[model samples]
Target: MHIVVCMKQVPDSAQIRVHPVTNTIMRQGVPTIINPYDLFALEEAMRLRDRFGGEVTVLTMGPPMAEDSLRKALTFGADRAVLLTDRFFAGSDTLATSYALAGALAKIGEEFGKPSIVFTGKQTIDGDTAQVGPGIAKRLRLNQLTYVARIAELDLAAEEITVERRAEGGVQVLSTRLPVLVTMLEGTNEMRRGTLEDAFRAARTQVVTWSAADAGITDLTKCGLRGSPTIVKKVFAPSARAEKAHQIPTADLSFEALAEAVMGEIFARQPAIEGDLMRFSSGQ
Candidate 1:
């Protein structure tokens, strides 16, 4: 059961700033960390490998600096790492990102047998769109599982996997065949620290670096910004709100007074709210 986990190195949100002239995120001089969500996915894959007895591989697509993230994954016990970095891959939105990642996955499979499962973080902090994992599944034609909170069961021999997906209002427990892509939710488990031996091994390991052509991409038009449909025509920071909240002055922070003030405002603004309040007073 070989599992492939996709991870990304992202600029720390705290350190990120918008470039005044270009209207783009100013990534320079910002500390990078593994996308917070990706850490969960990596840990989950490692846990599954420990239980099912197989290898886990971590992959990332970013600037050359992202090699740091791949090496970190190795310290956590991934059997291999791959870096898909090239000038052409810059400014890629979800569609192009997915295409590039899928191509790298294919190359990894060719190098080390096919994987039984692919895992990814639910969403990247930098993108925050929660679309790439699904897009990758669509490109690869794998059964898609987003917001997977738990792996309920896995019958490797039977070629079936069951998982609990966190959905609005309820959980969806679905079963799908092998070779599925799962976007794992955060906080499932704590990330493990590498031992000295593991760290040494990771420092010595060479991550496979591939260009667009090396990954079997012959069509340049399908690999980067050209492949993306969504375009960011404008980027700007949110403007400050003009009006401030109305202050509720009170020497005594009494619950009844607070409730009365809130009700008064609601009733003044909305006649329907007054009627609802009356009905509530009369036990509906």
Candidate 2:
């Protein structure tokens, strides 16, 4: 079984700054890290590889400096790393990004046998759109499973997979075939720390770097900003709110008392909510 994990390098959200005049993100001097959500995907892929006795290849599309994140993934036991960077891929929105990524994935399959499963994060911190994963799946004509909480089973011989997907109100159990794309939810598994030997191997490994042409991406018009139709009219931070939290005091710290005190505060703020809760509890 070959598992492909899609990852991204993004500016640390904690230290990200918005330009005062331009109202755009100020990336200069900002440190970069693997998209936090993608870590869960990587960890899940590694776990699957460990159990199935296969390889996990991590792929990312970003600038040349983004190679740092790919190397970091190797330290976490990914069998290989590929970086897709190109001038034509600059300023790509989710649409163009997915297109380029899908193309690169095709090239990867040509070099390393076609992957049985592809894993991606629930969302990226920078984009927060959560569209790229589905977009890639759509372009590649692969079955897509999003917000997957658990992978129940995998039948390599039968080429089938079962997973529990988190939906709006409850979980949805789904069974699908191989060559599927999964967007893994966060906190499903913990990322492993690399051993000294693994770190050394990662330091020496040369990441496979490819440009748009190298990845067999034709039609330059469909890449970068040229292919993206979405327009960003403005990018600004929300105004700071002045509201503060209200504390509810409880005597003796008893569970019942604390619960009642918290409910009392909620009722005090929204009297209608209390009546609604009572009616619902009484099945009205």
Best by TM-score: 1
lDDT of 2 by residue, 1-284 (tens): 88999999999999988888787888999999999999999999988888998889999999999999999999988989999999999999999999999999999999997999999999999889999999999999889999999999999999999999999999999999988999999989899998888899898888999999899999888899999998777767788778867766656789988998888888998999988998999995
Best by lDDT: 2
After superposing candidate 2, which stretches have Cα over 4 Å from the reference? 239-284
With a 3 Å backbone cut-off (N, CA, C), the pairs that clash in candidate 1 are none
| lDDT of model 2, residue 66 | 94
- For residues 174-214, could you state the per-residue lDDT of candidate 1 as single tens digits? 99998999999988788998778878888888998988888
Clashing pairs in 2: none
- Candidate 1, lDDT over the whole model: 0.89
Q: What is the lDDT of residue 2 in candidate 1?
A: 90
Against the correct fold, how does model 2 do in TM-score? 0.85
Error of 1 at 127 (Å): 1.0
User: All models: lDDT?
Assistant: 0.89, 0.93
TM-scores for every predicted model: 0.88, 0.85
